[model samples]
Target chain A: MISPDHFQALFDPRGIVVAGASTHPGKFGFVALHNILSCGYRGEVFATNRERAEVLGRPTVADLTEIPHGKADLVFVCTPATSNPEVLRQAASVGIKAAFIASAGYGESGEAGLELQLQLVEIANELNMVIVGPNGQGLVSTPSSLCAQIVAPYPPAGSIGIASQSGNFVSSFMNLSRQSGVGISRAISVGNAAQVGILDMLEYFADDPKTSVGLVYAEGISDGREFANRLEKVCQRMPVVILKGGASGLGARAAASHTGSLATDDRVFEGLCRQVGATRASSVAEAFDIAAAFSTLPAPRGPRLAVVTTVGGWGVLAADAISSTSLELVHLPADLRDTLDGLLPPRWSRNNPIDLAGGETKDTVPAVLDAVVGHEEIDATLVLGMGIQSNQGRLEREGPFYPDHGLERIVAFHDRQDSRYADVALAASIAADKPVLIASELAIGDPNNAAVAAVRATGHYCFASAERAVIAMHRLYERTVWLESFGEPNNERH
Target chain B: MSRTLSESDSKDLLAKYGIPFLPEVLISQADHVEDALVGMTGPYAVKLCGPNISHKSERGLVRLDINGVDAVRQACHELFDEARPEDGATGVLVAPMATGLREFIAGVSVDPVFGPTIVFGVGGVLAEAIADVTVRLAPLRRYDAMDMLGSLRSRSLLETFRGEPAVDLEALADLLCSLSDAAVGIDGLESIDVNPVMIVNGLPVALDALVEFSDVEVEP
Candidate 1:
């Protein structure tokens, strides 16, 4: 596990040096350097390439001796496994407290590689240096604008801390989040997990002030009891979402090959996931959505929920989603029904979905929201097909308008309507201590629409699909239910 | 690679920790059959006891539903005749033929990574096919046992289905916890399979059980 002091040095480094930064873009060192410089990191970064005088625009030093070594906090070892021990020795001499090793050919390559991995860990331990990965992609800390990873461009910066085992999955999750406008706080790919595992990352995330959520994509865990104990502790402070791969015999073998991780029966893992309070997401996208909901929205007090939708079909679809999750589309109380009777059109479906059935206009969204979230019986609300059509319709209409006329007027009008509806929905959700998930037909289609982006900027997720929104709400409820089942004590975390 | 303990011995082992097995007696000779059946009810099940015979009924070493002393003696003779050199039968044993509205399998197996784990599910002939089972790490708390029971896909079997009364889940949980305690506590114990535990009037009664000890040499 990365210690508290080391987390600060590794994630929020004031000064960083890339040990093998390359002049060539094709090399891993160059990719690592370019990501940090392009992400607008406020901290100073030095490139150490013996073959080159400079990397990108930054001046290159032959070694740590060229710079004030004691001041550099983190060193990215963009070198081979064979040279990592010497780099560790050099880094330890410089007083570097932490490092992210992007080199593979560690334990994943077999017996010999496992020996090398042990050597690397031994060196780091002796030097008191926190090592993130032996065979990892890289690490990214959004709060510090530190994109030290060698993958896709940095994801939109926010507060969801992600720790994934597969580097490819981390990049894919970031790309998906980028498209969905889901912001990330910190993400690390714990390759081989020779030193840091899911539990260690989760513990660090717990102490992270900027991180209120921990998301992990793990293939396997080394110790079941230790993992469970740490997970239960971390969950008390911040909601943790885990998406495990390798559920099958063949898949487990694959996972073992990829990360040198021992595979437990998936069923046992499920039992442990329930025994602890972490919500298990079945897919990468679901993990992102659930983490976003748990981090942004207040957990639902109960499983009872209400769906308010402009499109009746979407409400029905959301109802199906609610059924699949541990949520109920319960009947509204008489008092809430009376309020809705006064607000919604007479033709609106007098059911739990509260379908507008084509009777709603953009102006009526506020009152419709007031009645839906206003119910004491409802624990959470899913507002589907709300004012999403405006973004897509406006974009298409103004696509070739006035042969290059100013499009700000149409965009502003759309933002005004979307923001107005969003405010009403969020205010009620906040006041009632319940979450309001918004999904629209067209705007939700983009998922990262300007309106959705504006709403997500507030930290809450507004999904394009009503089903995902409902599923996220259900996951939040499940997390609360699991915690409640444990009767979490005040001092649950150590 | 482990040896199976005899039925009576296995029952004794489980009874030490509060697993309720049916009343039975081990008789090395047919003359002791009538005496052994003294406390048992009218219907009885006679089986050939062995150190290595794991499946008595499948090996034709078992005779069930014997009502009279003559029938009991005939069953004893038949079981002895059926026993082969490999059957490993050393004596005849008689147990009360337990009847119940439901059957369940409660046992423990050693998982290579997690160590001992408790298994609970529907039992009898359909156990393998129904395969509606749930597992929890052994040395389970009462709460863990209850959760395991509730998590079974065939959980409805424990409820009052049709006109049959619901199986006493609290009692089942106790049985599971006891087995888990043994699975975790005993160093020599490798696995225990108590199949078709008869649920007589909602109370679980072990009708048949097999306890296997680890064959691996323990480090001195």
Candidate 2:
């Protein structure tokens, strides 16, 4: 294991230098340097180019040794693979502790590239510096507001930390974060993993104070036992959601070509996840949703769940989703049913879902949510179709009768009420020490919906569908169960 | 590079590690059948045992449900006669016929990446077709063994089945742990296949076992 200071240098460097800074708009050298300076990275920035010139309005040095001593702690290597060894040696001489090599043509490119990758590892080891990727995308550390990657869209700063074996998936996750407004603390793509691997980044996340949950995308594991051991240690501190890529024969072959990875048997990998108590997601979307839930919600005490829905179909969908998981859809006890009956219409379903049946008054949704989330038998509550009011309000505001009928005031009131419902659900969940997952298609269909905005304002993700909400709750419940297996309390992390 | 142990030798090696096997006796000649059955019960299965004869039943060298001593003697003589010259037939193994309502397969195979892994699941002739199993890395903890049993998709079979008691999970867990121990302790061990681990009134007993060794010499 590397020292904490080394990881800190990788993630929270004081100053940074781009090895191959360029003025051309097409080159990664330009983009990497542009993203760092543009994303509000408050540090000393330097560039090394073949010729001494100004790039991105910053004077470029012809070599790394030109940088003053103790000025730059990290280097973003954009030079080709053949020159990386000399670049690393120069960076080491100048007191740089970490390097993110954005250059390709390394281990994934075959024999000669593999040899070059070995040289890079030897230099990293000799210098005792963290080398992120020899053929990978860049990384992001929101604490420093550093989006040093060559990609666009730096996500909002939040708790979920991501490490992926593939660069495109990192970009995809960041894109989801940008669209959904669920921020990230740190994200790195360990391409080819010449010097630093996924486990190293994950362990760093485990010790990182800003990160509450970890999302990992792995195509292969070089050492199964070591991977399991390190992963188990990380899970003890925070929940981890994993998405494995190469689980099938065809996928394994593809992975072998993609990153020179050897895929283990998918079943064994599945069993290993279960044994280590890491939540395994079947898709990238599912992995992010699960990680979002872990980042925001408290672990549930048990599997019992209460579904509160505005419509019957969402409730039915939530119920159907619950049937496939270990989560139990609790039967509404008589007392809770009576409480909901008092708060809802006579036609409302009195069962577990407690469907409002379109009969909710202004206060009905919030009052019913409080009653369900506060119930003793319910470990968590899933509120479905929450943004319907705001969704409807947007539609009516677009019509011709908007201001003529005093519709402006009515839409404003509807939006406020929708936002209030989100606040009340979140508040009630905190008061009851349970998880309340709010889901609506409007989260994805209409990102500007009031309820969606409200949930995002509090730094919690509003799930796109009932099934996605159910999957999140199920993962939370699994984490709780795993904690109990170690005789640890669920709320200890909180 | 690897050689399979004979049925009698496999059972002997596994019995040393606390894997329960039915009481049986080995006889080199048919004349010793009556004496070998002195303490054991009748209604036995007699099979030709040899280092090279790994699939005795497939080769029609196995006879079951012999009641009388003369019947057992006749079955042993027929089994020995049925053995071909290349079979390298060394002896005959006779064990009392045991009945059970449920069968399970438990074994240890070295995974290329994960090393020795324990596999447990539904057993019998359709075991391969059913393909219902779960694995855990070797040197399993007690809880890991329990998790393996619980993880099996056919886990319901371990419950009380057809008026018999539920499988003794503690003993079964112990068996799995012992297998894991052997996986780590034994030298040059390639694999161990214990199929049809019959559940009799809830207790598990290994009815058939095949232990393979690689790059090592062992007496047949």
Candidate 3:
């Protein structure tokens, strides 16, 4: 059990010290100091080095005790493995409560390194300090404006908190957050997690006021029952999205029975995930997309989904995608059809997809969205082909026609209309307390598409494909069912 | 070392946990076959039973659909004759042949990571070939058993098929719960394979069972 003070010191430190501060740009010491200062961390910063008097415009001390107060909340250690024990002893003496070991050559190297790792864990226990990693890439706490990692691409601040076993996957999720405009509250790589593991990070995220969803990437679990127990407890409070790595390895035991043969490690993990309510993603992209949905959307009330598309094919694709998931495509109720009838042209396909069939005016899409998303029978809505107008506007701007042909006004109108449609659909979803997923090929094909931009402006992702939208909706519906099974009210449907 | 128990002993241990099994009697000699068949009805399935004989059907040590006293005596004699010296043949098990439209499998296995897991799936000779099973860690809650049954790919087979009533899932869930209890409560228990749990009328009956024990010392 991690205490609140230790958790706070690790993430929201009042002051941080760089124990191995260096003048060379290539060393981790330099980069660690550079990131903390550059990321606008709202805390006091100190540095310590054996030779250098000053580094990165901060005065350095030979030892932590030389500082005025002999204290700092956290220490980012960029020194070698052999120097960590003494550094930790000094930090403990000075009242530092947490340390992020940004050094390697421990635990992943060999027998000697494993011994050193054990020694570090022993010292951490004696000191009662929360240690993040001995060979990890680093971490980012966006709420503190602290990007203390050794990597680039600090994500915008939002509701998703990520903890990964592999450092590169942490970078991968942060990159996704940058691309999709889905921000992260905190991100950490628990490399060789000797003290503070992925489970501890998840528990912190579950209690974090800034985090609304937890995203995890795990490769191996040492204690399966404890993992399941903690994961289920976290899921009860907030949705958890997990992507398990190294799943193909079968159990090595020479089984003497059929049940033994069938109980592979991966299959058992899958069962554990099902028993708990954690949404297991098949890929990194899927995990981020699901986490983005969980962070942005309200909990759907039921499995019933309504697909509203600008074109027939996308709607048909979404309907086909829904067949394999637990979500249902209900027939449009008469009142819903009548309401859409007043909004769409007479040539529209009056069905569940509510295909506009090229009959939508500037006001048609938003009005149709309002009617479909606000219907009592619809638990969720998927609006497809949202960027068609913006895509057309781009084509017109690049064509032979000039501004002399009134092209500028027409393009502006198209862009404004697409943005408005995006805004209206999102508002309707929130007003009705249901998930509204917008999908368009232009989201990926044209990065500047107005609808996608508008959706991202509000920190939500516009799924690149209708199928992806369906997958996200299916995950949301599963979360709702899981919550209902426990007789717990859904995540306050915001 | 670990060893697998004979089918009769396995059934006896599991039966104590409230797992339903077909009524059968063990006949040690050919002279005892008539008395063992007194209350039981034939056509009967008679199989050679011992601590060493784990797979009876694969070795052709079983005789099924045998009717009348003479046929039962002849079947028991043949099974006893087929038993090798190393097989440590103890007796022959005689039970009325069970018929059902659908067959299901349920059992328990101790996972290396998550110990004592319960398995439920389609059963019969094709159980391994079909490879349709769902597992839950024990001891199972009633809902976990129900979820296991509902999650099988062959779940539709549990519904009414060929005029047979839909399997009484509540009863099956209870059976699974009992199996889970046995998994958790039994000492030295390693694995259990209750194959071909025949759905008779609407209830599941364990027709064949195999239980393996771990860390048991072999007698000199």
Candidate 4:
């Protein structure tokens, strides 16, 4: 296992030196160097190579021996595997605690390469240093002035922390996080995991005050016992979302040869995850998606959910998803049903779905939202809006509800009159503090794009299709219910 | 990691788990092989039982069908000569000869995926050559073992094949269930193989058995 300090150094470097940094677009070193500078990192940056007198017009050294020792905190060994061991040795000799070998070669090749990779491990152990990878793109730190040569740049620093085995997947996740308005505290691509393992990163983030959620992308783990034990401890502190590959046989074999991971007898690992509070994701997308949701949404009060929608079709779809999952739709009492029946016209469906019909304005939508959320049994609310289709529709329909069409205007009016009604629906949810996901049936405007843009802009929970919203709601409900039964108090990191 | 259990050890282990084993005994010397044979009925069998001798038939360490003393004596000498001290063979097992119209093999092995698993197959070298076996998680129920037995391609042998009475499947299931239970109960145990268990007149009998365990854990 890697110490918390070592793992933190990779993501929170006080000073950085890219050994092979350059400004040339074609060279990997140059691309990495330019990305770090462009991300606006305020730290000492140095690029070195034997051939170049300077890199990206910054002072470059021929080698580590040329640079004044002890000044560089973390060294990015942006060279081939054959050249990395020597760099690690030189860095270690000069008291550099961490090195990110952003080069490719060794173990990932074949037997001969594996043998060479083992030698690198021996040198790292002897030096008491941690090596990220001989085949990694590198790592990123959102809270610090650090860019350890990770392939992609992410959003401004926030709480979610991600550690992954595939650099490409990490880069893709960063792209998604950026587009969705989700922020990340740090992300590390532990390629091949030849030196540092998953538990190392888990431990680091478990104690990290900035990180509220942790996501791990792994093909398989090396030490099952160690992995389970450490994760059990860490999960008690914060949520650790795991996205495991090798769910199939051929993929399992590939994972083993790729990273020397044990891929058999998955039940032991499964049992461990169930015993601990950690959540398991079926794919890479769910890992980050759920992490982002958990980061923004408050914990749900109960699995009981109510869907308030202007579109009857989407309301039915959301109800179906909610039912299929752990959350149950609370049956309205006779008096509450009578209350809802009097508010909407006879054409409206008066079930738990609470549809407000097509001609209803945004004011009428929130009125129905109040009745549904007001149900004492309701734990969370899924308010469905179709104005997602037209920007003009949002102005024309909801604009009347707001005096000046300002966010504060909407918030203030919501607090004064509609807030009371909406609160009755959201009371138990607010008191229990469950998240309400407000979404659109389908965009009426540019149907294809704005619907997606609307949900992404809110930075709240949204599924691509209405059916997915149900599944997410139900899954979230089931998860929240299970957590209530299993949760221990005062263990949260932030 | 691999060691053969003596007859008493084998039978005791199986019987404790409710698996039936024919009466048998292990003697240290060839002299005792004859005496042990006398206590049994007319039909008897003699085997060279040793810790190191894993493949008994391949090494010609087994001899069957001895009607009297002379045959028992000659079989013992031939078996003992085949398993000389140089072969690192242990002692010989003399027990009541188990003759059957049907034969089958059952085994339990530690699979890396599902842990202890029970495997059943058609008996003899031919079945092993074809690798005609089905495996399931261990500590098996009788129905699970029966299901595994019925799944084999050569399952017809387990029936009343060629007018021979049907092999007692109930007895086979019991044996398999018992073996699976033993495997689950015994940690650090590696493998157990019971091959060519004779089903005489539809009644099964263990002709030979082998058990092995690790002193230290081996990587799965």
Candidate 5:
């Protein structure tokens, strides 16, 4: 029954204390201390370590008792798992509102760990205090510019908020967010989730004004009906992306004891996702990429796509990618077909991939992009950067630019650098609103480097292959459609 | 939307829906059975009925193929005399025997995911063992009733299994459809179970049925 306003205490705190903080590098406590400082939090920040009087040049207390204020709005218990009980008991005596247990090796270890976790939960309940996790990475706030962990950088301050169970996976995801340029509003690691579980966080984020797109990295979920209902309500207004690990049996058990989560038959979750319009990603990378695209891109009008390339073979390969996804290689409209036919030599594939055959100039790239992207039927556009490089190189071999102008002057001033083509593609991306994928054949494994990076620098997609790009683009389209179509609580329309 | 009526309420509910039921009296105590027997026809069945009691046949609440006042009087006393009153007791039910029946089972339930549903199958032990049942979304159409009847693996029961005459399946389908229709129409209905829906010769009749109500506010 609690709404967004009630959840403010968890995300926005007036004061924060990083217990067990240190100046030492590579330690979890030190990393957490550094992250809190880096997030630009204006609130009161305190650090405590047994040995040091100062940590990262900030004044450190000998223990919780040394803080002059005598109390904190939130306490981050970053000590060993075994020491958490005593630390929590001491903190509770002073009426600490919330404490995040960033210690690992709790219920996830075995029966002994589970008993310890249960004891911690009982302690928190008795003291009327809230514990975030017994084995959690802690929480981050991009809107408030507050991060509680040292393992990763804050996501680029966007509307999407993520809650994950696996700290390592979530940390990696946060790192990936930096690489991909996808920002987040909040990313919380609810490890073990002994006191505050996914349901509580989900309800918090569902009504959270800062979050327009939601991502959950879950091992499993309990209370299927309640989760389904709550998510269905949230999905109507925001896209809720889900990545569930442990498709196998052993993983299912680990998932359960880690968070007291229910892992039902896999198909049940699949069916539920389909019914509720939640985007389900198979892997961590896919989850971030899909979440990235969904949060950043506009809704595509249709599934029809146009692949514009400078090479015929690259065009054929790009077309092949559409076979796996829902996207269709629509027939080029007659006017645009005629336009490409007139611009290219008769040898060019009149159909698509308008192979410039190395004869097309830098200016021609933008022109062709404009023609393809402006076509009414095209849902998205993919430009092959490798095709531009090889084809334009071939054209250079067959002709001289000018006899009047010197070769150095012509090459330096007029011809433009090899990477300029990426800029033109990026411009088309901005105009199209559809995902513009720049494919690099030379860098087969990591196409987003150099040439593809050239395009992505302009804020477009840089994929390894046309097929992968098409799949990503199609899934993004489906996610947008789903976000638009979901029902609002009891007022289900369809 | 499927509404369930208690045994006494079920009889009244079904009769109003045009389900032909045997004329009977619902006596609260064993002493009232002697008075109730005068109105009942000979060769009548005697049974105990209450809200808390379901599947009374297994509980020895039912006695069938009986004749004469002494047999009816004895069966009634046996049912009511041994009854435990503390078990959310409603009352005791006494009804005449429905003879010449080819038994079948009918019920209505509201599935959490799919909403109101109706169930049909063969009656008695075979129904439990084989579970030859069919389910249709409730407030069913005429075609849906036919579809449900045809769906069961023992659908041949509707068309003269052994020497039994082809139960008037069209008539039975109509009855099922009407019950589902009534269930949807009722305000407080939750679940309905009409077991041993006796098909006597060609005509169908209800031998026993039960209904459970929703938690709607009731006037005291």
Candidate 6:
């Protein structure tokens, strides 16, 4: 168990000290100090440097005791590995409870580095100080408006906790958050994991009120028992999306002749995922996609899903993806199909996808969407008609490209139609407590695209393609189906 | 430093706890083979044993489908005397040959940190290619066993397959529970691999089992 005193201080530090503060730009020390200041941390900042009296417009002290703010709550150590022992010793003497070390060449380098890292952990334990990394990147807590990492794209605040072994993913996830509507609550790159591992941070996130979904990228677990035990507890509350790595080479090794050899460590990890209620994804892209779906939608009641599409081809593609997952699409219900037949034209075919046919009127798409999403038999709905060109009435009037009297006029007319269509889907989704996922060829995977961003802003989701949308729908339902067995949840807070 | 219980002793140990092992008898000499098969019905399986011989099939030390009593005697004599010196055995085991519609593998694998872990899955060559399996930490409850079966990729094997009824879940659960109890109750047990727990009609009977002990010696 982690100490509550250190956990609270490291997360929401009231005072921060930059031990290796530098005036020169682009160095880790300078960027570490710069990020803390730029993110508007409410805590007091103390910069300590030996070469100069001040750095980066803040007065620097040669020693930690010179700070007038008394003992800082947390310290960000950005010095070399050879000098970190002395630096941390001085900080611990000043009653600092937590530290985020953003230096490298400690544990990951080799034998010499490993011994130094062990010594650092020993000092940390003796002083009761929680250290993030001795060879790690930094971390960020949106609740306190703190960004102590040098990674780019400090995303805007939202609910989703990320704990990763590779520090690069921390920055990459931040970039993904910028593209997708889902934002992060906390991000930690647990390098080396001398004391605090992925399971510990996951437990903290499970208890944290600010985070509703967890995204973790792990290479290997040193303690399988602690991992499974902690995972069981964490899964009882919030859902965890895991992306396990390092299996391509290990699977190629020579195998034993025993029948039990069939179950490798990675395969057992998949079993562990089933035993513990966590969703496993094949790639980081899928992990983020799963997190985005969970962050926006409620746990589906079951794996029964429906796909409502304007294009006949998309519905078939989506149906295959649904069946591939743990989900199934029964034939359109009798009563619901009857209602949909009324909304669709006479030319519409009869099927579960309920394709709106090529000659669909504007009313044909929205009417089927509402009826399907509201049906009790359906657990979740995926609507795939958010196209940019000709999706909003190519027949009623000449499209923008027909005659762009002016660029502004063409875009103005397109925006008005886009919002009108978005409102229909959003209102139908909000009308029902069930989740509604949107798909489009044009409005996908880009938050900067106002057409897609506006839909997401309304608490609705838009995926890049029909296949992706269908996959997300299937994952969301499975997470819900898994959580269903853990008894009733508090509510869909996200 | 370590010890290995013979097949007969391991079956005796499991039989005490109500695990469904095939009825078998141990013979110290070839002359005792016929007397041991008095109550048992044909066909019979004859397996030669030695202290160092763990995998009998790979070394061609096992004879199956011996229908008549004379055939059983000839097979047993050849396995013990006609084979190489390494294949010569101090004892032989004879059991009733059992037929089944489905095959399963269940056992205990000792993990360094978590101790014994219970594993259940499909058996035979398909076990590796298909990789349909599930694992639970020892001390499994009724639901854990049931969930273990349901978690397999070929979970349909639990349902009606090829005109055969599903294996009795209650009996399978009881077998797994007993297996778990034995694993947890025993000390210095390295691992146990019970393969081809063949299911006939709806009842399961364990046909073969291999138990290995850890090298670390305990005071007890």
| Model 2 pairs in collision | none
* Residue A67, candidate 1: C-alpha displacement in angstroms: 1.6
Whole-model lDDT, model 3:
0.86
Candidate 4 per-residue C-alpha lDDT over A35-119 given as tens digits, one digit per residue, 9 for 90 to 100: 7777867776767777765666676776666666666668887776777778887777665778887777788889978987899
lDDT of 5 by residue, B1-220 (tens): 1223357777787677766677778877666667877766767777777656655766777787778767766776777675767434545666666655357777665444433456666776565666566665566666557656755666666777566678787889877887777667756655667767887777778877776555435310
How would you encode candidate 2's per-residue C-alpha lDDT over B10-66 as one tens digit per residue?
Answer: 898888888889999989999998789988887898888887676666788888888
Docking class of 5: incorrect
Which candidate do you rate higher for lDDT, 1 or 4? Answer: 1
Model 5, runs deviating above 4 Å: A1-14, A23-26, A38-43, A50-52, A65-73, A80-97, A109-130, A153-160, A202-212, A247-264, A386-423, A441-450, A480-494, B1-220
Which CAPRI category fits model 6?
Answer: acceptable
Question: Superposing every Cα of model 1 onto the true structure, what RMSD results?
Answer: 4.9
- Which should have the higher DockQ, number 1 or number 6? 6
Model 3, A252: alpha-carbon shift in Å? Answer: 4.1
Q: Score each candidate by Cα lDDT.
A: 0.77, 0.84, 0.86, 0.64, 0.67, 0.75
Candidate 4: the clashing residue pairs are A22-A30, A373-A425, A374-A424, A374-A425, A389-A443, A389-A444, A389-A445
Name the 10 consecutive residues with the lowest summed lDDT in model 5 chain B: B211-220
lDDT of 3 by residue, B73-184 (tens): 9988888889888777578999999999798878888877777788887877787788888988888777678878867888889899999999999999999999999998
Model 1 regions lying over 4 Å from their true place: A247-264, A361-364, A391-419, A439-444, A448-451, A464-467, A489-494, B60-72, B86-93, B98-102, B215-220
Please give me the total number of clashing residue pairs in predicted model 1.
1
Q: Which candidate's TM-score is highest? A: 3
Per-residue lDDT of model 2, residues A1-494, tens digit only: 36787777777899999999999989999999999999999988899999877897888999999999888888999998888899999999999999999899988889988998898888789998888888778999999999888888799998889999998889888888988888899999998998788888888898899898889999977677888888989988888899999843432211101001211377678877877888999998999999888888888989999998888998998999998888999988999988887887799988978788999988888888888899899889999887788887998899989866888998998899989999999999889988999998888888899999999898788999999999889888877877788888788333
Q: For each prediction, how big is the interface RMSD?
A: 9.6, 9.6, 2.0, 10.9, 13.5, 4.3
Candidates 4 and 5, the one with greater lDDT: 5
Query: How do the candidates score on chain B by TM-score?
Result: 0.93, 0.94, 0.95, 0.85, 0.86, 0.91
True contacts kept of 6: 0.21
List ranges where model 2 is wrong by over 4 Å: A247-264, A492-494, B38-43, B60-74, B82-89, B162-165, B218-220
After best superposition, candidate 6 residue B27: deviation in angstroms? Answer: 2.8
Order of models, best TM-score first:
3, 2, 6, 1, 4, 5
Q: Write the per-residue lDDT of candidate 3 for residues A232-313, one digit (tens) a residue.
A: 8999888899999985453564255667777667767777777788998999988988999999999888888998887899
Flag the better candidate by TM-score, 1 or 4.
1
